[model samples]
Target: MTVSLHTRRRQSGVTLLGLLMWAIVLGFGALIVMKVVPTIIEYSTISKAVNKIAAEGLSTVPEIRAAFDRQKDIDYGITSITSRDLDITKENDKVVIRFAYNKEVELFSPVFLLIKYQGTSRTTTR
Candidate 1:
């Protein structure tokens, strides 16, 4: 079968346009993923810390308070944390910890927006 060059060119343009559209959609998806991923990671980390204390037998607000040794950061949106001992807890009683941090992020991929991420962590003694 013989096809016209004009027809082929037109088809090419259409393919290009479709590809561009797909790129746009994917870009937005990537942007959103980036914005949300950090929150998930931060919260998970904090949660893990709480669980660690929980496994250690740190249960109760006072025990948590006593065990909580670091401020790390306040929950204002996108908080940074460095692990450290700010407080002290008993060796075998029940100990627990609770805290929150905020994450602030801006996105510009296939879309543009600013979002604030609020996350908290809690752990109890097993």
Candidate 2:
């Protein structure tokens, strides 16, 4: 059977429409991911900073407080920094450092969702 050129062209017309729809869907998806990834990275940065301080082998409340306090801008891309309720106490006979923080992320249109990345970290005394 011989395929007609007209039929082939008709098939391409639908393909182009599908391609355009897909491109738009993917574009928005990329935008959402772009907004999300940075927020996640910021939270991860907070965790790393906390862990780094804990690794320093400081067992005092003042020392732990200093560690977190000193790292004000651990991540350059972090847009918002908020300190949550933190309690540095001893648990299981080990020093426990628990802190939570909130980070905000901004993105382009579609109501411009304001995402918050909240994270908690804890460390036991050495």
Candidate 3:
């Protein structure tokens, strides 16, 4: 009598197509993040400017705008929205300065991304 042995083989791995697909997805995500990072930095700068304006007791719209302009002049990153676009309001007699703007970034042909940013002072000076 003779004994016989049988061996089975299985294949498991990512194909070329799968690798390309993953690369595409990650590439798109990286592109979006690249565009978003600068926007986030600008927003942070704007927030700091707003907080500074409020802390300095700049209640009037003109005063706040001028303050922001000065800040923008000092820091070039705050260029998206100007003083004219600011929304100054009063809540319970406390001055509130708010601003909103949109940034358009093109990823590829006919593909664009819209980023909206808005912020207000943390606390009123008065």
- The candidate scoring highest on TM-score is 3
Report the lDDT tens digits of candidate 3 across residue range 30-84: 9899978998998999989888887787767888888889988999998798989
Tens digit per residue, CA lDDT, model 1, 53-94:
456554455555443333223433324543332233434444
In candidate 2, the residue pairs with backbone N, CA or C atoms under 3 Å apart (3 or more residues apart, or in different chains) clash, namely 95-125
Backbone clash pairs for candidate 3 read: none
lDDT of 2 by residue, 24-107 (tens): 999988988987787787667767776676667777777777677667555565344533344666667666555555544456
Q: Give residue 126's lDDT in candidate 1 (0 to 100).
A: 48
Query: How many clashes (backbone atoms < 3 Å, residues ≥3 apart in a chain or on different chains) does model 3 have?
Result: 0
Candidate 2 off by > 4 Å: 1-14, 73-79, 82-85, 102-104, 109-125
Report the lDDT of model 2 for residue 93. 65
* Candidate 1 residue spans exceeding 4 A from truth: 1-14, 71-105, 108-126
Q: If the candidates were sorted by their TM-score against the true structure, best first, what order would they fall in? A: 3, 2, 1
